[model samples]
Target: MPGREARPAVEAQLLLASCKGGGPMQKRFLFFLALLLIVSLGLLAACGQPTPEVIKETVVVKETVVVEKKPVKLVMSFVPSGDTQQIITGGEAIERLLEEKTGYEIDTNVATSYAAVVEAMGAGNADIGWLNTFGYILAHEKYGVEVILATVRFGRPYYTGQIIVRADSGIKTLEDLKGKTMCWVDPLSTSGYVIPRVMLQAAGIDPDKDFAKTVEAGSHNNVVIAVYNGDCDAGATYVDARRTVEKDLPDVMEKVAVIAESPQIPNDTVSVRKDLPPEVVETIKKALLEIAQTEEGKEALKQVYEIEDLVEVDDSFYDGFRATLDAAGVNIEELAK
Candidate 1:
């Protein structure tokens, strides 16, 4: 009986050992070989298909674009007129005229003071300027500004500076200003100060040493008004200064008397920086002359400078202005600031 029991257990062990033999190992090896064969066939089939060709191409463009550039910008500086709004509006109008006539781009600047415009010329900030006779002299001699045109006010290429007194003040001559309070518009005024000073000297009176009090009334209109109001015994201003205040003081002409008249004075000038191209200068002058011929243009310019026309002129026309300054012993280098 014991032998029979051990015989069954031994049989079980033999069967288990037989299961672990070549059958499972051969099956696993065959499976891996089949998988590798399938992978190889897939790769070969993929390689057998025709490969697509790559093509490169070049393209050409055949159009051209041409650009036209505009002219250089021109900037003009101004010494302000009586009215601020009038000065600005008139300046813009004139800039428009320049552009329309010259085919140029134009801009404008109204300097805070007359000397500011002069300094702008010296610094090359301005290409053109509106300068008074004395201011033109200062800019020409010191800053290389050239007068291109002379502004004509009231149809005259020349004007006169005057010494004015209230009509009742029996002060009839320049000598009467000797021991009295004197008002001068400003040192820069050719008519108001410079030319009148020369006139006073020619009459054998020293403006510096003779006057009891020398007052700067600030402007030509103010100079006339102060004399008319009896604030000043006598004053110097442009001969046309009474016209400036005629509307305000309708009897301005009746109230103020011209004690003396200065020698013929050149009108204000239209100037340009000296280094500008001559052709360009001539073009500007031409445009300005055309502007003068049109009534609307004159009316527009009148607000700024009372200019009715622009006339051809030479620098020699201002020689008298220089001589007057010289006769007064005025050192421009000292007076210009």
Candidate 2:
């Protein structure tokens, strides 16, 4: 056929042209043309084929963070009205209950004397104080300590001070106490010293000069023990304080007799420093009231200060007691100084 004859003729022409000794430039041009043609064919073949699939991978990372918080802390101080160790144990129990209720860390301590407790509240070292009547008065006047609660005993918000003496001492009357040795709880003690002193003055006897020797027994329990042991001819304490020692001294009630009882004195107080936060004070008051209702709290209160219950009170609660002190010529300002 004509097509087959034309293809052989073109091949014969190309072979003859290549066999001829062409110039170097002409041969280079021919070689480039051949390469260009081959590349074009390759591109056409590639375009005709299907395209390949491509995949991309991604990596993820995560981060975590944590935070820590610290608890609020408070300081509570107690007046050593009875045994020091026993008071401390009770105070600790109260601290735990308060901490659990309020979610605040509480530290408790019993001061060596009533004045120490007052001073601690004044100096901002103690946030809470268990203060006696006279001590509370002094603290309130000088430092503006605020009373939040009053302790109850024998179902009474008020308690009386007693002038106690051994049954065999023959000290049947306040006048008979003259020229006799006397044991006092502490200078700042309300029932054991202050009110009893007022009682003595009303009877025409001076506590400082009438007694041949006066001893500060440091605690009501100590005063009771001192009188029972005859360390002093007579002593003063809270009414019926002899029962505190009845566990150890079974004959304390028989050996020590109450010769006299002072007029009604306000019970001890649960006071707070003047600068304490009002919210904190309220929290403490609420926590204590709740704690007092529990059996554990009742036992703790009994151990700390023979407290039967706690009742809310204010600065006015001590007004009658203050008037009695005023009439008795006891100056609060002077005592504070």
Candidate 3:
């Protein structure tokens, strides 16, 4: 500790004796060798056991162990305009299950419009999303969104849109509403707007130019309300929205009746951000696939999404939607832009 104070007299005497027996050249070599040995032993004795090298190695190992313990956060975005409470309830259940299964915390964001979900995906606001068929089509075309799962209602991968009217109203069919007021849900909604619009166009009626009044009610529930309250002669909305109405607002259910049913349209799909890591995407796909198999999950999903299950399907299901729009001569590119 005090710098090897005055080398011990005994050690000095021994070193001198060893040097005395050698010629001048040998003495110099012996002196240097003795000095080297003394310095090495002093360093070893001062460092205690396991040396500085061992301590540095232990620190490096501990640092690596700490780095390996970080957790992953996965964020999901879903539609949130109606029965938000039910939506959050179902979403959190799935979030908790996903966290348990994958060991990653689940974070969720609710988008007011289907188009807004697309925007969230594009802006990197969410790692996964629930998007309507119309938004799915637009996202695939413009944002390259990756569809990993499809929600099925009543054990089918597709659902329908029913153009409805007050049962007492004179409107009986698509043609009967030619000069009547009509309400539309979101523009990027498959059953709410796109499919219904396509069906109307097929019957030689132009909703924009021929209707007496065209109003946007923003959501499927709003469209139902508009028609039920006589705010519009007819309204376009997804069939599941009618279920929500029957269960939540029975008063409206008794007032409206479906006069026209659009052809089956694919239900919403869960899409992943294109840039998400492959493993994370796989984990999401697995979690979604499991949701339909469990009892509580099935019930929660049915209440919020009316989804009996989630099925794996390829991108081809949406190709028909594109074909339908193309047949109508509608420019989706312009709409998404």
Cα lDDT, all candidates: 0.81, 0.90, 0.79
lDDT of 1 by residue, 242-287 (tens): 8877888999888899978888889988999888888889999999
Candidate 2 shows a clash count of 0
- Order of quality (TM-score): 2, 3, 1
By lDDT, is 1 or 2 better?
2
Tens-place lDDT per residue, model 3, 192-243, is: 7788888988898987888998997877878887888889999888875766
**Poorest 10 consecutive residues by lDDT, candidate 2:** 1-10
Q: Model 1, 233: alpha-carbon shift in Å?
A: 2.6
Alpha-carbon runs more than 4 Å astray in model 3: 1-65, 251-254
Candidate 2 residue spans exceeding 4 A from truth: 1-70
Query: How well does model 3 score by local distance difference test?
Result: 0.79
Quote each prediction's TM-score.
0.74, 0.80, 0.77
lDDT of 2 by residue, 49-144 (tens): 777878777877766666667777889999988999999999999999999999999999999899999999999999999999999999999999
lDDT of 1: 0.81
Candidate 2, after superposition: displacement of residue 336 in Å?
A: 1.8
Better of 1 and 2 by TM-score: 2
